[model samples]
Target: MAESIRTGRRKPAGPLAYAALVAASLFAVGPLLWALSTSFKSPDAVLTDTSWIPSAPTLENYTIVLFESQVPRYLFNSVVVAGATVLATLVLATLGAYATARFRFRGRGASLFFILMTSMIPGIAILVPLYFLAVEVGVYDSYLGLIVVYTAWQVPTVLWMLRGFFQTIPTSLEEAGRIDGASDLRVMVQLVLPLAKPGLAAAAVIAFVYVWNDYLIAATMVSSDDKRLVSVGLYNYLSQYGIEWGQLTAAVLVTIVPMVVLFVLMEKRLVAGLSAGATKG
Candidate 1:
């Protein structure tokens, strides 16, 4: 009788859940879709075309931005800066996080708490002093200046991330490496790093994205067109007279696609690393 009743009554397909998901997807994707549509539209079509689909698409804007502008140079600058920042962040944060995770030291708790709290501090608070410091160091308006500043700002978050991930690693593995006559560095490089690749990858990606998207710091430090990062370089489309809507939208789409592609590809590792770190933390 129970089996008969179960078979007779079918469950609802949960249209509400599907509807909610669709709404959320639209919310997240709306701006991106708009940028993409604008990127393809002629300048006149952009203001006139109210529909998401472009009524008259053109490639002139993309060509103007991609071929005739300093965008390529800005992209190269961003890559160099972001890459250097990631390497520095990983090396320093790894060492610091491992120390905090494995060693017993005075003020360790306070230090970790302080570092975490600093991450919440507004960038605007430190902007003036940071810019002055960069100029004083003679790295202002240069890749080295941007790289150094980005590394400093991004290190704390990476430190906390690596610390959480390190806590989840069993100490026995390090002990085994030490029993094999390995030094602390050897153990970390040989054993722990391999195990922590997912977390490291996640941290690396996050650091790179932060540097790539960074605007205020880079803008303050770099006034030269040649030194501008892509985030700030987008403003080149705006002159004293007016803004280049079509080219600006094209640049926006170009900027977004690479990061979106990277996230989509590495989302599995990112999610696993973040979720595991959250649990341990």
Candidate 2:
């Protein structure tokens, strides 16, 4: 009788919960779908009506954005600058993190905390000084300038993150390497690094994404249109006459796809890295 009654009854979440889930899903995907629809839409349709999908989808926007506009150059610049920034951040942050983690030096906590405090400062606050320094160093208006700027800004967070990750690594591993007559560098390279792979992957992904999407430093540091990164390049789509909604949407979506693909491919590694330290700690 109990089993028969249970079979007749319905499952939980009758109305409100299901509605909320459906609404949340739509909310998250709506904008992306809209952008994709807009990218293929006619300029007239974009302004005239609000439709989820384009009535007459076209590839003209992509063609014009890729061939006629400076979008390709901006894409190239973003890749170069972001790539360089990530590489620099990884090397500097990893070394600093290792030192902070393994060695008990004077004012270590104070230094780490102070370094982290800079994250709270708005980029606008230091823009003027950074611009002046860029000119002084003769790297202004150059890819190197933007890369260096991003590296400096992003490294502190990476250092803090990696320091925590490095700390979570078991000391016994290093001690074992020492027992086997391995040098400190060898231990770090062979054992410690191998164990900390997940953390490094997470840090790299974070650094790459931050630098790729950075706009403030890119705009201030790179003056030449040819050297502009994607974020600033999008501003060019706006004009006094009107905004090129279709072209701009196409450009934005194309710009986002690569990073999205990159993240999706490495998401597993990134999650593992983020959890590795936390789980151990």
lDDT per residue, candidate 1, 1-281, as tens digits? 64566456787549898899899999999988888888898888878897888878899989988899887788888888899999999998999999999999999999988888988989999999988898888988888888887888888989988999999989998998899899998898899988889889999999999999888988899989888888888875566227767788888887777778988998887877787674577
User: Number of clashes in every candidate structure?
Assistant: 0, 1
Error of 2 at 237 (Å): 2.5
Misplaced by over 4 Å in model 2 are 1-21, 278-281
RMSD of each: 5.5, 5.9
Where does model 1 exceed 4 Å of error? 1-13
Give the range where candidate 2 is weakest over 10 consecutive residues by summed lDDT: 272-281
C-alpha lDDT of candidate 2 relative to the true structure: 0.85
* Cα error of candidate 2 at position 8, Å: 28
lDDT, candidate 2, 63-111, per-residue tens:
9889988888888888888888889998899888888899899999898
Q: List the residue pairs that clash in candidate 1.
A: none
- Tell me the lDDT of model 2 at 66: 91
Clashes of 2: 1
